[model samples]
Target: MRIFDVAEITRNIKEMCIEANYSLTEDMVSVIREAAKNEESPLGRRILNQLDENMKIAGEDQVPICQDTGMAVIFMDIGQEVHWEGGFLEDAIQEGVRQGYQEGFLRKSVVGDPFGRVNTGDNTPAVIHYQIVPGDSVRITVAPKGFGSENMSRIFMLKPADGVEGVKNAVISAVKDAGPNACPPVVVGVGIGGTFEKCALLAKRALTRPVDQRSGIASIRELEQELLEKINRTGIGPGGLGGTTTALAVNIETYPTHIAGLPVAVNMCCHVNRHAVRVL
Candidate 1:
């Protein structure tokens, strides 16, 4: 089996942290541009243009697109054939986040405690998820999740009979409840059919998928499109100024579940939607 160095992982994570915060992905950029053109409200179109300019400026200056640089959330897919060397994988990832935030001048938003909260100083102890697969290569994804939209996320337990219509209403209700606070023109990630925790995770994973990419499953793809249309019709608009461009995309990820229960989660992400991935 091939041996991989934790230092290598650390190095990559550092760069990813900086890059994701500063650079809006190409797919996201293209989608926003299209949204601007299609936005029904004059104010909505103008807001989208301003957002585009903001992205351009951030990239050119190599500065964070948002002041809330966000808590570091990492996802790793490690090949079973590979062995780790050099240091503990968990520590290495946190070190990478620390160095990235310090050196890149990204804000440190993570806290040490939930109730009696204080800054973690370096944004240490990243929220990391690991998965094992068949190959020798490792894939790492860094997604900085700001709290604005995160705070608006919700999970619902629906009866098995609730089905598609229930899922639709729950999603719409969550967005409506969020109003402008979660940041309009948001990306909605819907996780369905899994257990309580798994469903929440499915929603988070959904956000990592490219906004333009639809699920391979035909029925799921149709549902995504339907949800997108209905969410935009809410008229939350750009920056919540009142318009037809409330949400940019709706993504759904599902898993097999028990016969008696249906769990659904809605994870909201603002237009920034910052995420970066690397494989080694």
Candidate 2:
């Protein structure tokens, strides 16, 4: 067994929080750049160009790409053979978020209470998910989810009879209704066939996958491509000005479900689908 220092987790998370806010992954950047070129509408193409320029400036200036710095969502895959030391792991993670937001000058958008609506002061208590695996190394993924697109996400509990066609319609309808509000030129993360909450989590996790990457499962890959094509055809376009570049990608994840139920969740993310990944 190997000893792991929880302090390292804290240090990495702090840097990751700052990194994710300042820039997007190369795959995401490349896709957006390509979209700008192929965009059929002048306005859409112009909006994409502005987005590209914004990304460039954010990196150079060390500023967040979006005003909403977002609530931190962290996913961790921990190794079973590892032992943690140096303090409570949970506290360390929260401290990392607090420090990152304060030091990096990223906006603190997390509220302490749902209804009372007071700011959390330092963006503490991130939404964290943990998983155990066989390896000795830990993998961390930080996704800063902006509410502009998050608020438009949806979950549909379709009867098993609804099948594949219904799944497609549910996703399409969500995108149609979201329109500009979801920050068109979106990345759609879809979860199909699981319990209600599980599907939502799956959908959220799907966003962490590279936009250009498709599911390894052949059928799911086809569905992803088809959904992406249909979503782009919706004419939502970049910045919702109406064009052919509505969505950048559609990523889907699936798990086995109950015989009687088919739960589907659609998690919407803006063009700035921000996430940073690291391993230790």
Candidate 1 positional error at 43, Å: 1.2
| Steric clash pairs (candidate 1) | none
TM-score of each: 0.99, 0.99
Write one digit per residue (lDDT tens) for candidate 1, span 215-247: 989999999999999988888899999999888
In order, what is each prediction's RMSD in angstroms?
Answer: 0.8, 0.7
In terms of lDDT, the poorest run of 10 residues in model 2 is: 59-68
TM-score, candidate 2, is: 0.99
Model 1's number of clashes is 0
Q: After superposition, how far is residue 198 of candidate 1 from its true place, in Å?
A: 0.2
Clashing pairs in 2: none
> Which residue segments of model 1 deviate by more than 4 Å?
none
The digit string of per-residue lDDT tens for model 2 on 1-280 reads: 8898889999999999999999999999999999999999999989999999999999888879998889999998999988999998889888899999999999999889999999889987799999999989999999999999999999999999999999999999999999999888999999998899999999999999999899999999999999999998988889889999989999999999999999999999999999999989
